[model samples]
Target: MFLLSSLLCALAGHVSAFLVETSSLTDLYPPLWKECPGQFSDYRVENGVYTINPWLYPERMGMYKILVTFTAEYFERFAPNNEANILWGLPLQHGWQYETGRLADPTDETKCGRENGNHTCISVDSWWACMNYYLSVLPFFGAIEAGVLGISSDQVQLLPPPKDQMYFCYSVTTCRSTFPETMTKWSTFFQQAMEPSKSWDDLLKYLWDAHVASIEEGRTSFDDRSLYFPKPETDFGKSWATAMNYIAAIRFETTLQNVTKFQKALPPRLLKPDDPPYFIEDFTDSQNRFLFLLHGLNKMHNDSGHKFLSLFRNLMKSELLRKMANTVLEQIILDDNISPQELDIIFSGYI
Candidate 1:
């Protein structure tokens, strides 16, 4: 009996450790706001534009450091010294440092200097910035190249830089200008791909093809002069999609409860717009109505307990829809995996 009890205790300990590890992995990618509080604390939505506080970049950098460290630890544990991992990981590490430098002291010329007639740096921040400016962009460029080359996710590989080659800073100004355009082009492409009545699997395939085509046509590249879009390949796409679905599912369930609580807090007449005044006075202008609804919903979210739903019953119109969509998208990148079917499953009967 004592031996059996000891065995049971060991099993319990193993289970507990497993749960702890799993929880840590999930914490690596927390909700958007949770990941970077400084960046999101004062975030305001005005006319669909998101203007973040640049001064908060340091805090964002801090969050990135933790994330990068976790990523490095993951790689070290699973695939130490892997070239592909190194190729991507190094840049992220350097990029964080580079951004940190810019945040720390942007105007110090002595922060960056020349070595072997090439730009080097005395400060770690400047050095990292210079290297990251060149290397950080490569992973993005490499993804596009893989698509163009018809390389599968498993086949994706990057060539190491030549020895003695100077890793100097590229034109950050040019990259900033072109990157957004590339992103816009990809967004349009995805929207167009979804216009056809395709199954979820077909949509994923179409997105993959479109990504390749974009790269082949010189629409996306690492060069600051070229357009660039960040698209995950099959494996990463699947994993990302699964993660998004899990996040959405969890958030959807929690949000439904919150919505119920919000409803209870609202005034009765505002529930379904039975009275014309509810629609005319409160929701005549769509954007204005959304803003107003968001304000009230945010208040309810902050409040301690559930109140009467009738107080803000007008939220049933479209506020909940907007809130759910915004919340989900804010937490995850919009990828091909977010299909109509998936959305239907997530939002069905919620209204």
Candidate 2:
């Protein structure tokens, strides 16, 4: 009787761990599994192993969402069938941190690197670091693209292109080495904007205004020049100058609701050079930088953008918000019978 009781307890523990380990995967796809219980019949199980049949679901979004939500272990289960799938699959399973192998424990000072002998660590994994890196690299690509299209450096400097900063020309000119200082300023701005009481609508409005202001600054710079006209010899020069005027006019004619419509109406040829795919294979820094911008834009347009931003704002204040925003429930849902106390303990980490 004693041996049988011990055996039952061990089996129960094993089952609990299994549920905990797999809960993360299920939490991400609650729409297909949790929300609609009978829909899981679409997936096939063979030898206790589950496999997704691509033919069963004609929509690519479903497959793509699964790829994105899968953990590193789950990703390995699906042997990559093609290079395109591999490219998409890797990022979904593992975010940017995968290259680093682990996320730096922010609480542990030893894990972080100090900046210029400062005691406080400057985390390279922060959003600020990523943004700064992209800003710094944009000039190099801008110069290269200008040269390729036979557009002069002066022409490039006169316009604030997408992914390029408002003061990019100034940075490349008088204060080429002030990237660190600029990054610090941006970091402070983000920190302030993400305060719990800050208004989300106001923040988004400010961003839109800043974007419009940059375009106006570029146009003003272009107009101030003695030679404002593009050379007739090069198609790029004419098209670029024309596009700048169109972009400026767009701000006045369109409202926020019509922004998507305006974007769709723009000539595809004018936007080709700025596309992420064009720069993906250029350099490691450039690739990651472009990908970050692309991902950020997508997130902003997605339905969860407001909720995600709101959750992030409350990250330091509310433990519950942090858990939901960071998807911590997966790690905490360890057993079928979890007490409220246990749930609180799991979520009480750091924040």
Candidate 3:
């Protein structure tokens, strides 16, 4: 037992070390990452309207790029070289969405975002793209409102998709008028980021608060677009959204390392037509376990919502503790020999 304890400690230390020690996020990437506008000047401007097209992956990623560059100074105090920037989550998640083919046009109208077609176009017809708009645009909107974008709110304009015009709000004026609460939620995070004497934990709280608010709006925003996909993909969206509440409640460190690790645990694409524990040939054991764990968490949350999550969050308060917890979860997913019964034991009373 003593030997086993030492081995476990060593494993945990390895996990912690791997997470903390990482190169720059821009150096490592998910394809089409070569160029993003780190400056507002990279964007085309005519008549003072800085048009950013979210339907194009690079254009949307530029939004994240500008955000990271502007916010780097603030995060430098938290970690060496600012590679641990909490804002890594935004671009990281967007990269995942793109690599997974979530940015493709769902309507099959013009082949705007398929592998054989326009690979980088983020089709507004895509359910995933619409859902991601909330995450991307709201935060960018926040940064603009907070004066981090170096342009007044009116100067920047989002070019919407040709269709589904009513589903989205384009400019700072329109989005603020439409989704006021969600807009303010993201704006507050940016506001908090600019203030002095803020810690990483404080920023994580603000980011997660705004993140959940964006997810809430996304859940409702794409009723029609979500129908373009089959039932399983749509259900996966629900499960993923449900699981996020737990993550947000925990304020799971959105730092560079954790987000990279977290991205690893996600499905390469949208949830396959086959559900987990049933074996999709394309999915690895880790992906299967991830889906299983997500489903289990979502089920328990529906059974008993929000009560134990606060406790779980408290339990995972420290950064080291959160890293260790993520390591254990990754180990569980990697353990193919482990059965449903064992997973149940692990999730028991997790609510």
Each model's lDDT comes to: 0.32, 0.31, 0.78
lDDT of 1 by residue, 215-334 (tens): 332312223321111111112222222232222222222211232322221222112214331133433233223223333333443352434233322342354553565465433223
Candidate 3 local Cα displacement, residue 282, angstroms:
2.7
- For lDDT, candidate 1 versus 2, the one ahead is 1
Q: Candidate 3's residue-wise lDDT over 1-351, tens digit each?
A: 999999999999987776656444445654565587667788889998888888889999998888887888878877765676788888888898888877887667878888788898888877778888999898898889988778899898888788878888888989899889989988988888888787777888889889888888988877677777666677666788877877775567777676787677677876545554425557766666677687777777676666656667787777777767766765676666875456667676673
Worst 10 residues of 2 by lDDT: 81-90
Instruction: Kindly give the stretch of ten consecutive residues in candidate 3 with the minimal lDDT sum.
Output: 271-280
| lDDT (tens digit, per residue) of candidate 2 on 128-205 | 222222322222222222232222333222223233244344323322344433333333323333354544333333
The prediction achieving the highest TM-score against the true structure is: 3
Q: State how far residue 159 of model 1 sits from its true place (Å).
A: 34
Error of 1 at 47 (Å): 4.2
Ordered by lDDT, highest first, the candidates read 3, 1, 2
Q: Name the better of 1 and 3 by lDDT.
A: 3
RMSD (Cα, Å) for all candidates, in order, is 23.9, 24.4, 8.1
Off by over 4 Å in 2: 1-189, 223-262, 270-351
Judged by TM-score relative to the true structure, which candidate is superior, 1 or 2? 1
**Candidate 2: C-alpha RMSD after superposition:** 24.4
